[model samples]
Target: MPSAHTKSPRAASRTPLIEVTKLSKVYVNDAVETPVLFDIDLRVQSGEFMAIMGPSGSGKSTLMHILGFLDRPTHGKYRFLGKDTAGRTDDELAIIRATKVSFVFQAFHLLPRATVLENVMLPLLYHPTIPSAERQHRAQAAINAVGLFERTNFLTSQLSGGQKQRTAIARSLVTEPQVIFADEPTGNLDSVSGIQVMGALEKLHASGHTIILVTHERSTAEFADRIVHILDGRIASDSRSHSRRSSSGLTSLK
Candidate 1:
């Protein structure tokens, strides 16, 4: 886990980046309804880094999907930036996801034939507000942030594992989203590459991006300001990082 040199910014009064109440999920297969997450209540402050941890089949991934708006909860209300998302249409959710949220996956999901810069620029294609030149500039800046400016022209296949992952990080950040969701970010990397990718994530968090990472690795969970542990579809524990202590001595994870 990486530690921050500067303290995170305090949240303004009466606003939460994420809010979940009585959230639950059920999957029905072969006429059998299987519950995954049960009555989960969670809140994430603006610019906070949170990690979700659990063993396989513990429903951490299911919870993540709900949080990311990739799936809807069976019973619950989710408020993102004070707006209830329960009744939002797929197009509405897509709009929010495109403009406000970005995602990075365990596998570098870059297009195989596209150059690093091009791959990073792909997100901007959805934004009619940005011009082509500005998109390229933003993409280059994102690539540079991950220390891959020189390799921006290289194809994904031409890069090393670490470099490819860095490109993925760059692509995620190029959209300048308010929040980022990363799922098992280091699961597919070697130790050295994993460390590098984790370092990049830490850097992004340090820059005040709200991040939610879903991973089973304790070491990876340590990078977050709060770690929410799930088991058998329920929240087992929620622990805060040592650095996010409040003036009154309360911490986010606690």
Candidate 2:
């Protein structure tokens, strides 16, 4: 249900970035079937901030995996940008995941020995389209987006937990994805660091990146424009909320 204060869904006029209907997932290991998601239906419009919140073992992770193209649904129809994704091959999906979508997780996933700039530039190394001469400039721009320009040369191992996560964000942005899947991005940080990371996410949203966050914290979920709750492999509630907490701790990257 829409809250009384909930405005119409963001980017209502924009094309849908993702659409899924009757989506289901089941694992068959040694012929032992284990169902994970059931008859799920969801649509995400372009330029929106959405958060998926649920307790452990509630199938949120599985749902995210399917949504992010990491795992395939056993039965369902999924469309990306109005095109059916059901017929896509593994290589096609990989190409989409590599060039169109990005991910940020609780783990920093940075190289201890690599400087922040090098780490951010890593993705372009595999991209056949990017010119080597432009990679550094692109990487620097991403680091600036996440407010890590000053630390561009710092080693990942020497940074604080929050800084490391921001570095991860920079890496995610280097590819210029249309959508980002952030799974428990704040799970490993302290309270202050968590707020900073969330603030960074908010800043990104303001810049027109579609954000899909999965978290167990209400405070973090509240940051998003809408929240979807999952329980027992089913969606319990899907509602819009405009309750973004104050980004008081935000710092200027400039």
In candidate 1, position 135 carries an lDDT of: 91
lDDT tens digits, residue span 1-254, model 1: 12232133445454777889999999999999999989999887767888899998999989888887888999998998888999889987787777788888888788999899889999899865678779989999999998998898998899988898889889889888878889898898886677778778878887988889899988777777788899999999887766542212222223
Regions of candidate 2 where Cα sits further than 4 Å from its true position: 1-10, 249-254
Per-residue lDDT of 49 in model 1: 81
Misplaced by over 4 Å in model 1 are 1-12, 243-254
Highest TM-score, which number?
A: 2
TM-score of each: 0.89, 0.92
lDDT for model 2: 0.86
Residue 107 local lDDT, model 2: 88
Give lDDT tens digits, candidate 2, residues 72-108: 9999998889888887889988888878888888887
